[model samples]
Target chain A: MKLRALAHSRTGDKGNTSNISVIAFDPANYERLRREVTAERVKTYFAGIVKGDVVRYELPKVSALNFVMTETLGGGVTRSLALDMHGKSLSSALLDLDIPEGEE
Target chain B: MKTIRIGSGAGYSGDRIEPAVELAEKGEIDYLVFECLAERTIALAQQAKMKNPNAGFDPLLEPRMRAVLATCKAKGIKIVTNMGAANPLAGARKTAEIAKSLGLTGLKIAAVGGDDVIEAIRETPWPLVESGGSTTDLGNRIVSANAYVGTASLVEALASGADVVITGRAADPALFMAPLIHEFGWAMDDWDKLGKGTVVGHMLECAGQVTGGYFADPGVKDVENLARLGFPIGEVSEDGTLIVTKVPGSGGKVTAQTAKEQLLYELHDPKNYFQPDVVADFSEVEIEEIGPDRVRVTGGTGHPKTATLKVSVGYVDSYIGEGQISYAGPGAVARGKLALEIVKERLALMQVKTTELRFDLIGVDALHGPRLSAASEPYEVRARVTGRTDTLAEAVRIGNEVETLYTNGPAGGGGAFKSAREIVAVQSVLLPRDKVAGTVQIVEA
Candidate 1:
């Protein structure tokens, strides 16, 4: 079963934030979805997912890493709770990753 | 293995330090909470303030917190605490300073205030919740007060940025609940969900009390190796069901029955287990054993907050500075009482009037408290007495002459006079309608 990983990022002067999702089959391969997929992995990861800049914050004290995966989650501005195809695209990409199982 | 953690919530004294920490090393735990503020701490801190405003128990957190913080930080575990009494900002800063001193930066430090309005009583009117309590009748006797802030602050601290949240006054359940909220991102107004969260919080508030530290089933095997006992944890779900369990292969035992025993501990009524927001019906909170270590609990409710936030205030206060000349060789009790009588006569002759006069031998029934009352052995006793006076002159008269009993009264053990001076400080407590600020303006060292 696939779970949605929502990406949140800091944007603009006030540090406005955004979220995008990607399908994750397992937590292990989540690292490969982007170059340095971190609170800051958004800029590289969101290249095709969105058309904007991303700001990242590594707030480890809270054990959370935040990002600005802009244009990614915001393209569907007219609808609230809207699911953009960008996240769906990432999910589709993730759903196809071939698994080599040692089955540990 | 599923984890069960437990530790004393507020055995908040330096004396109770070793035992509380040793419970963990003797066992397994996902988390630990220490409740370090109680009426006695409030009283003690209040008295300390009179002598020197800031010269009080901040250091007390050192012994207990050091052991826990060092271990938890090293192991990447977490702690929720209210040892932040008097000044939490100071405590958090102190923690950060220690972290920096040890090259442990990025240690999330958060402080929750704005709930601690010491001056609230004089301004806003608190809508009466019950009739017998008019809140008005309480005149100056109110000293070293605090509001019951809930889990929201801890949740926010965990949300925004904090490896550790040092709070002033919050319900014990809040500490545990805040972590769950941070983990699940549970919304605040979700009463049913919050109810579920609170039930989990309630189960683990008392440390060892839940995990056989206070009570034991005679049938169970060795409870020794108590040095590292497992803490209790409630694996709660959104619907308010939880398993009260400890770490697998731990020092304590957990069963639906043992969990039930803990549920009854320190609580007045099972059906009416109360918190700030919920009149939690323990009857509603059901428990089941899913397996060896998991005792599941369910069915609880939460109400909207009556106050936006809670207020806790601490200030300088006075207490009966009492001491005794222990005359325990022989004829101790009788002579002690006689000496007390002489002090009374002397105070009366000297025109001394006080609010109260207490005379009782330490080993006798006059001494009452949670633990020491359990000591049944009789020993040489002091006729420890306290006389309150408005003026130090009058107070000094009683405090100064307490030693005269040695020469005049029939002495068994030699008597020595001790000081009886108390300091009283008043704090005006108020609940503000704002969340505490999480922004820390960094200072360049």
Candidate 2:
């Protein structure tokens, strides 16, 4: 199952860095999100677009995982020649991440 | 239970004006805060100021004030905004003039200054946070440098009995935080309260975003009546607790999902979301939907602020040339690819110099590259060619190549559009908090 089945995401950019937060649709899916969505996997998933390190911060109370990826936007919004300057669509792109189905 | 109801009027500089007017007339709020001014907005405003001294503020400032001022004044709802952009004094003066013209008397408009620190930045060498270079390297290219100021000056403006407060480059959340501080008498050192207030500000800063404007995903995360989406209003008590809601009978639903998505918008480290007032922590924030279109938010705390403040430095980066032409019917994808190839070869043959270039199919691979795009091809696609160049002449050539496709290269290519503009890039640097001062000047009508 895709991550979209269990969670939703939003992307925010500052300079060259982009932070994307993936929140579970149901509170019960929080543990699976934490276990499956690792920073290493996220960095590899956005290999071409993101050029720097990825840091993951967990917000258990909100059942969300925040991934901060550096050098994500071509440069920054102002300098980047990309069509989506703010990388706003990246959040939707991240929702396409595949999450293995677990026992219900 | 002394509580103040604050309405978030406008989210960004170009946000809708009617939503704000709705808040002013019907929201029943004490304060209406407009959190305008993005990272690059002030830098662009600076360029505007260079062209004309009196025209650096938000262009919609006049229209927005004209729309809501009389009603806000009648209801005794004070207005706060960073629409001052690059010139708060000019903004304040203009607001005073508007108020008087509207026959509203005894209104005090305060302009908060000291956010502009280009001269102070030039006096010393400050290291750039993004790119590993110093401010000295930017030299003459530096157009504007403004620090993310805290709630102090804004609070001061409110405390002085100002009816409207305007600023240029303040921290977005601080606009909402200032009223909380002034009304509740929350000390500047009260980190926990400031943190909780910051959460409210962050939630409300985006206006319609918290109310379901950006959360609509059609069938999956469906939001109703987005076209008439209402802005948010925060009901706050003296103890820093807040209930986020919208005016009754307004468009857009304020469910837990919408509030949750907004809570993480533009936030990196939930535990250390830095602001001028404090380092707010939202990791433990609880979002519970107490009633229809109402969410109770609590459990946000904060740590002491850092010694230095983040300054956004804007400079002339380069010129960008973008062109798009749509192709439809059968074999549109193939034709679009051919057009890109033709433009690529044409630019090379013409010896056009560009630092970066991209060929994208708008409906398909424009957003995410081809790697992530769907395998199946669409019946119609818009081909876009964009390039960044040092010179405007070189930049213009990129779009010219794409426009040439209408006649020279591809078949059925229509809606050819092109634009060439200079890019003003923004970077960050840290300066000692003491180096930048905050000042408030009041203008009365």
Candidate 3:
């Protein structure tokens, strides 16, 4: 079967740009979210593997901070094959970290 | 160089014509897309299900849809659509029935479900409607509850040999994007490529909107045969850029302004239009209507969403009826306004509330009433208010009191009133990516 038709799903690495519209219930949570999620960590972890710029966006309306990673997915969209990669592991990646509050 | 064609019809709020198909055949364009899904439409589909468990609202009713499907089948064209409202299985069965009726038996049909997490409202604890200043808990009151499942399922169904794939409720762009992924064989974790396809899907999701349905160009009126509108198609390459246009000779103009409007349909920021793929920047974009029926769109950044769930809810008319009132006189407009205002004050005193209220002042709002030979000097004002709330007694009571407005109004125009039945509410919960537990069914024919 073609990779596109495969049931396995992998929703990842929006290049170096990630639209993380996050929020926090309180300043403590905000600090926790900020401490836990940082551009440097994302950049350091995926810096070698992914290409492009990683930027962070913070909103007052959002209790959390957002990240926008640009041009990180293997020279933009044309050469992607991540659909075949099992996305089941994301549950673990997300479970460990806090997502704070999210908007849209 | 192939393209996919699709559209929306039936129970939707716009013209349900098949202008998309007509243009594709005329221009030999590959794909067509139609997008029409609102909170209200799913309600109609639910009501349809009440009468016939198997029958409900589907978009195939638009004249062009039938014409396009028939013509495409005859000419060996592959078509994809999301006409399925509530019961995709039933919808696909009906599509097959139509194909057989047309003697297009080679047609393959498939339905994608299990995206509905509505039943999980009890198991999962999602934020409520007020979380985003909108209601989120669409309990049993829900008229429809289909997840915005991605388009890969449709691709799977198509791969199963479906000449036409129908879906219940997948994200609009997913339908268009998955086809490209299937054709290209793009791999998982390829977020950039997926984003590219997503951008293409977003471009063609609304057929005319991308074309000229809402363009601002002043010189685009000369295209002939506009009565039949043309459908849109996106030629997406591996790199996340594409050319958006429709079938030639199709009604509507494709210009930069049109692209901006559609781009902003769900865009929050000019440079930060984030989807699953590229964090697209509207500011970083350039548009050139290089030739007829073609507009090349470029410059989109990529990003991911922080929140996993958005809320959607619906309503079902408990009871429905039509009633009208007319007014006449030189002071018709002034009096009508006063009458409605008075009715509102009275209803407030009576504690009457409803889900929706709309009033249309017909004769006065018409075009050049003074220029036409038709002179209905009678200052008649028609006010129609319809809504579905928790109770009908208060609604009827309010309706009765409003009728008395004609006697006491300053304009002295007589008033008429009637009460329709109330409708029920269907509520569901929106969950983040982790909580969805249903399994999808993909049958290959």
Q: Per-residue alpha-carbon lDDT of model 3 for A54-104, expressed as tens digits?
A: 565443322334445554432222122122112213212222342434421
Share of native interface contacts recovered by each model? 0.00, 0.83, 0.00
Candidate 3 local accuracy as lDDT?
0.51
- Residue by residue across B1-445, what tens digits does model 1's lDDT show? 2233434334334434654455446434555666766533554554454475544335666656666666666666566677766566666767776666656655776666433443565444443231124334445544555567666667767666566777766776777777766776777777666767666776676655556554442433235445555666555554455667665655666755455545543343334444555545444555566887677766666655554443433323333434467767556667667777887787678776676566656565342211223344455776665665665556666665676666666566465656755444322233444533322222111
Residue-level lDDT tens digits of model 3 in B328-419: 76767667656666666766686666544444344543211222214444456654443334466655755665567667655555547676
Candidate 2 ranges beyond 4 A from true positions: none
Better of 1 and 3 by DockQ: 3
Chain B TM-scores of the candidates: 0.74, 0.99, 0.77
What candidate 3 gets wrong by more than 4 Å, as runs, is: A1-104, B1-14, B57-65, B129-140, B215-228, B270-283, B304-311, B315-329, B345-389, B400-430, B434-445
Q: After superposition, how far is residue B216 of candidate 1 from its true place, in Å?
A: 6.9
Deviating ranges (above 4 Å) for candidate 1? A1-104, B1-30, B39-57, B63-65, B68-71, B124-145, B216-239, B245-262, B265-274, B287-296, B307-318, B327-333, B367-381, B414-417, B423-445
The per-model lDDT (C-alpha) reads 0.51, 0.92, 0.51
Reference-based lDDT, residue A87, model 1: 37
Decoy 2 TM-score against native = 0.99
lDDT of 2 by residue, B319-360 (tens): 999899999998999999999999999999999899889899
